[model samples]
Target: MTPMNPDADAVERAVARLTAALDEGRPVAPVRDLIGEHDLAAAYAVQRELTRRRLAGGAVVTGRKIGLTSPAVQRQLGVDQPDFGVLFADMDVSAEAEVPSWRLLQPKAEAEIAFVLKEDLADGDLDAARVRSAVDYAVAALEIVDSRIADWDIRLTDTVADNASSGLYVLAERRLGLDEFEPRETTMRMYADDVPVSEGAGSACLGDPLNALAWLARTALEFGDPLRAGQVVLSGALGPMVPAPPGTRIRAEISSLGEVTATFSEKSGKPEKRDA
Candidate 1:
């Protein structure tokens, strides 16, 4: 196994190579194979290094995204629970951004009811109502997920080190009061290219967004990083993800809340298939 402190130069090379592959359509080394029998700390440091470089290149840190909040998703990844990654400004589409289809490679979109926090929720007992009290607003969000792993074949650790397949997020222009919304009772439909794909109730996301948020609170605290006030939480994917094809429009509608959409960049499209 790799030691706690992996070679800094090696980590840098891995990050740079991965970033270059993403830009130039080159094949990337599978993360699992790259870190075989290695300590997680070493692998994680590579992720941080990659994050730093992306930031230096104009990626703005906007919010954080949590993944695997659904127990079903956790079981699929063979993990106990969820993980997180910082959201870059580039990942957000402010209700006005134009999306053409083509820039993303094998993308998938899922709807989520997001919680915009008002006050700090650290060390608090977070039931549904308590989570509601901490919320300042709610918006319908679409999470555009893309896996860096080759063929989407991954273990829980590979996912963690890959930053939870972090992708684009679209926030609806229409925002509603948290108290006015029942995320648990909420239902949403996922559509791709004007075709109805799948639908789900809030229960799909770890038994409602609030319970998902509560899990995040406790997990963060365990990691020595508690969630702070004003951090927008994407409770998790509301519906089963629908394949997002380029030149196609993707959207979602949350009950009583609103809708969000994502249009990929036409000219900047990626390859249609992968070796996954």
Candidate 2:
């Protein structure tokens, strides 16, 4: 019989804990205790297992989302680097007239620049210049980030294991090429119920959104999963994220990329009780 690897076993337990929280339609304690507060690899292991399960259940890989690109946020989370999470087909709520409230636990909204790639970043050194040429277009995006950890009391490992606290994303219809506008210079303002709540510029996101993409490309390549063509990449938040409670209408305007909005339904996604 093959001996069970303790670290691998810990990862499994962490996955199970998170999966249970998701299935129960509620938040749970942070998974950092199980995977260690600083074990990024173990945290990612849990995320990968969750992704595998989602794929097995027929979810398609649409793209990826970068998290913690803001220096302030990194400081808040006590992590010096950014993290990433998979973007699945179902996670795209762009077409929904009103976003379902129950689809998330505790969600916050942030504005971002979404990049749709035209070429693979699998070959050659993926510098900023190389990554820029691969972009097919850019769009304004609103990301509804959710946390499965209770009260969002999370360390870096906790959020990383919980798919970088991803929930749903909405992209603007307007698209722009690199030559049309410089990403680093774009400004952003987000509104909740038409009241301005958050604001920042493109430089808030890892100096530039393109830099975030470049980092993701290099990181993904190192992990043996180089970014591919036609994948949508949410390059990280351009400003602070605000609470997105049920029935709230959120909108974000990017100076050059245009604006995107999402109106959440009033009802929460509370699971119904079932007979044992």
Candidate 3:
């Protein structure tokens, strides 16, 4: 199918609708009809404009998050590759703080490894080894992914335009060096309210989380941004995501990397129905 060529006005309208939904904690209808199904380029442009608006509104870009690196997630979404989104300062949640569930729409939780870089990584020649060398440490993380697209009925273009369906994240307090830790060997088990719900190994993330990081480094450069020092990169999920609702406590324990927890509470209002 030939992609639709959108003008500046169309992109602006799409961005405005999405940003409003995000701010009001509501789900918006799929924008494919507005942006066109095959116009991924224009979808990404909309995402960039939204990011720019968020930055202008005082949200700092702390890092980036990779999505769909796991085969399980790819299969669930019927997609074959990964996409990414920028992480803002407000998206970082404390491990001990209670996440206001009412502030989100259709939230889900995934176990992941987060990389904090100590050195800048440029655009080209990014490999797992190169990516590993640039890391400061890796922490066990829980990524709470929420979608503005109602019912999470999103195509690749839909999600990419919606910031890869990214939401808030919680990182473990403890950090581990990569010298003794192997990304592929790390095992992860997630618990909801202390009951084990899902489990997987780091290899599920594109063979290794480092590979996901390398992919993000290369892809970010293509987007005119390099992996900067001190930026936290979410390498991707190690297992399936579990539904997270108000008053639920989700915890993730990673082999050698330590554990992280996210507790949700009813802060605003009940979650709106997102299923189509």
Question: Using TM-score as the measure, which candidate wins?
Answer: 2
- TM-score, prediction 1: 0.82
Better of 1 and 3 by lDDT: 3
Candidate 2 per-residue lDDT, tens place, 128-232, comes to 789999999999999999998999999999988999999989999999999999999999999999999999999999999999999999888877778999999
- Tell how far residue 25 is off in model 2, in angstroms: 0.4
User: Candidate 3, which segments miss by more than 4 Å at Cα?
Assistant: 1-7, 75-78, 269-276
TM-score per model over all chains? 0.82, 0.95, 0.91
Runs off by more than 4 Å, candidate 2: 1-6, 268-276
Please state the error at residue 4 of candidate 1 in Å: 7.8
Residue 248 accuracy (lDDT) in model 3: 91
Sequence-dependent TM-score of model 3: 0.91
Compared with the true structure, all predictions reach lDDT values of 0.70, 0.90, 0.85
lDDT of 2: 0.90
Q: Tens digit of lDDT per residue, candidate 1, span 53-95?
A: 6777777665567788777777776666667766776667655
* Clash pairs for candidate 1: 99-263, 100-264, 101-247, 102-269, 151-276
Candidate 2 positional error at 115, Å: 0.3
* TM-score-best of 1 and 3: 3
